[model samples]
Target: MSDPAALLRAYDHQLRDEAETPSAVAVERLGPLRLATFRGGRGFITYSTLDEDGRPATQESVLALVDGALAHYTASPDIHRVEWKTRGHDHAPGLHEALVGHGFVPDEPESVMVGEAALLAVDVELPAGVVVRQVTDEDDVRAMCAMQAEVFGDTPEFAAEILLQVLHRLRTRDDMEMWVAEADGTIVSAGRLEPVAGSEFAGIWGGATLPEWRGKGIYRALTAARARSALRHGKRYINSDSTEFSRPILERSGLVKVSTTTPYEWRRDT
Candidate 1:
């Protein structure tokens, strides 16, 4: 039997701790959680484990930690939104309820998929006239961001926020990469590859494809390109928090759905 729990534990130990925010304004520890404050009044919460053995987390301790984490961010005048990230494979009993009780609204859950990079680096047949390549210039970045916002059905402001962050990272980090697929002089799909610092894992993120271009292997081809890039960077594994539409594709590419993660958001009262 494939041990999903074992894989999750290894991911938590190896990747979670090593992937700290590069530009966080403030970061504090509250029990197992790392509470981080970032630019634009954003806050993030993540933890290695609530219970490492996959047993149920103690309710009292869990509640206390949640309260403490909330207090830490709530006391900050700069924080306007906080996201508490939770994983399904964790022993986080009452965690959802506790977060909701504290005014946190849950977002949709996503599959946590992990696998060898070699499996995803296979060459895929691209549609006629479709081409994929890495992009860095401002104009290319803006075009990629616009296409992604349209594909994901998000507002332009959302893409603008992402553009700012990606641009900042581009200036500071060489491990980040952006790829886009184009046909007939227009972008059809886009994605990001983020190689975690000090770890063997790289993440494939922000994968979006125009509805008209679905099922033509464009997304898979983009993934293959990112996986090949990861290998060149010495990363052996690829991980992603996948939506339902992309989960099967990653599974077919040999990534295992070891767990699910949800984000609970707390927006400060204006």
Candidate 2:
């Protein structure tokens, strides 16, 4: 039997490919790597297994692929921010060095948490006037995106436009769903669940609650709702790119932080 870590890596490789968003724009295949493009001037790159995908492209070859893609995107002035998304569960041999060598700087490794849905589905008591609801309309989705921007310290326009694209996806395909908790008739907490096309795990993303509403267990409740939703779609596990704030909550809910993902950035000047 493969080690538990190996199983986790296999899962990451398959799940990411199946679960990626559609408006993802462009997808470039180099060996087993998937270098994808999305809206928001973003370039995302991921690999199935840095070492075990059976493609086994050499370190130098992988570096060449990164350079080729960077150069391709640099030709267009609109490509300002590129993210080389890495997973901690896989052996990325020389990925860090390669990315840095090509001028990509590493960002934080978010916690990747996954576990059974039953562990997270508990009724949480919000602070008296909060309500949670699923959103299927464009306006509500945009509003939720704007709120998330505020909480994460980003410009409202940046995320709203990005979410507009996501909304189009949600409308055309029913696989994606967004939910938020409303308090005093205003959204206070939110999250989204995306089911992978051919996998057993659904990715839980964009979870946030107002700073004032943090400790009341609203976030946990939001997670439970998403887990139950995932189960409805036949998904057995949930995964997330969690912040430190949400990590402990998820850990308490029985999800294991199997790996860490750090995003590296690069610019024309750098």
Candidate 3:
């Protein structure tokens, strides 16, 4: 699993496809794409590969597929935003042009980090007064999300919407675990662990730490706590789409950057 090529292969074989859409409210198949609709007017598009009928994708076919996927989400007026997840290693031709031509704006690329969960399960000494633990109560979850929104600089209205969506998921789902690092009753760092059912992978997502808490071991400890939880749930591998700040930490924790993922998003107004 330490080998980058081997890890990337395992990721493509195990973590892609329907396994990526476990929490979708509804899912539809369009060509090779799995178009997912989630709560709060969010739509997601992902696929294992871009091959059509076992043949490599041509520019024309890729454009057609993008249009079809967009049309599929457009038909549902309730979907206010859509994100098409694109992998750097995918055999997609003219994907960037197609997505942009269809009104999708690309986000910053993230490193697709993957490795054994055990590597992240080690104990890390935390800064004085900072404590990391799992959080399940409504109040604690809200605080964690609020701290994350502040760290990420989310707008008030958008932050409220994210809080509602997160609370809804917290109430309705048991597959995800929320963790936080708090000091003197204020949350400083937080993240979520999503153990994929019937797969060996668990996703570490939404990791954010307050600026003042950066450079300390708080985030690493929070990750270790979540990794232990994933191990308890029988997941062997941990995967994350990490931002620049987190990629180096995870790399130090034994994860390899298997590839890069950039999300192309389209808002309803656009």
Candidate 4:
């Protein structure tokens, strides 16, 4: 796992196939792409690798694939927004221009981090008043989501939609778990652990902390809790799409930046 190339190979082999949409409500296929529809009018496009036929993807073929995926989502009236995920190491040639020409906007790219779950399972001492634990109750879940929104500056409507989706996942699925750090009965930090079925990878997602609560090991502790949970569920590897703030921390915690991922989004006009 220390060798960067080996880590990237392991990640591509074990994690990419089902990484994007484990909880998708419906899923379809378009050539090598998986067109996934989630509960909240969200659509996602992902594939393990674009070179499905032992040949690199050409500009024309990539453009045609992009158009086909968009057309499929556009035909579904309920899909208000769709995301076409692109990886830094992919062999796609005209993906960016094609997506832009087809009305897709790119988001900030994030590091695709991978490492041993055991490296993150160690005990980290939290601040004097802080404690981290997994939560399932509706009230705690809502508070966790609201705190994340405040920290990330998300719109109330967007936050509400995320809350509803989390609730639905909690009620319907057992593969995901929510964890939070609390001090004096208030949520200070929160995140989720998603153990991917039929894979050795578990994803630590939505790691957020209040500004005042950072630099006190609370976020790391919350991550450790989730890592332990993932280990208990029999997952060997930890993966995350990390922001700049969390990338250094995960790197310090033994995760390697295998690649980068950028999302190209397209929204239907209201």
Better of 3 and 4 by lDDT: 3
> Per-residue lDDT for 1-270 in model 4, tens only?
667788889888877756668778898988889999887788989999776678778999899999999999999898888989899998999899999999999999999999999999998998888888899999999899999999989887668778878999999989899999999899999999999888888999999999988899998999999999999999988999999989999999999998999999999998
Model 3 lDDT tens row, 109-155: 99999999999999999988889989999999989988998988988
Considering lDDT, where higher is better, how would the candidates rank from best to worst? Answer: 3, 4, 1, 2
What is the lDDT, from 0 to 100, of the residue 52 in candidate 2?
38
Prediction 4 global C-alpha lDDT: 0.90
TM-scores, one per candidate = 0.92, 0.89, 0.97, 0.96
Cα lDDT, all candidates? 0.85, 0.77, 0.92, 0.90
Per-structure clash totals for the candidates: 0, 2, 0, 0
Query: Can you list the residue pairs that collide in candidate 1?
Result: none
TM-score-better candidate, 1 vs 3: 3
Worst 10 residues of 2 by lDDT: 1-10
Clashing pairs in 2: 109-261, 131-182
lDDT tens string, model 1, 121-230?
99999999999999998789889988888878776655676677777778777868999999987999999998887888899999999998999999999999999999
Question: Model 2: residues >4 Å from true position, as ranges?
Answer: 1-10, 52-59, 268-270
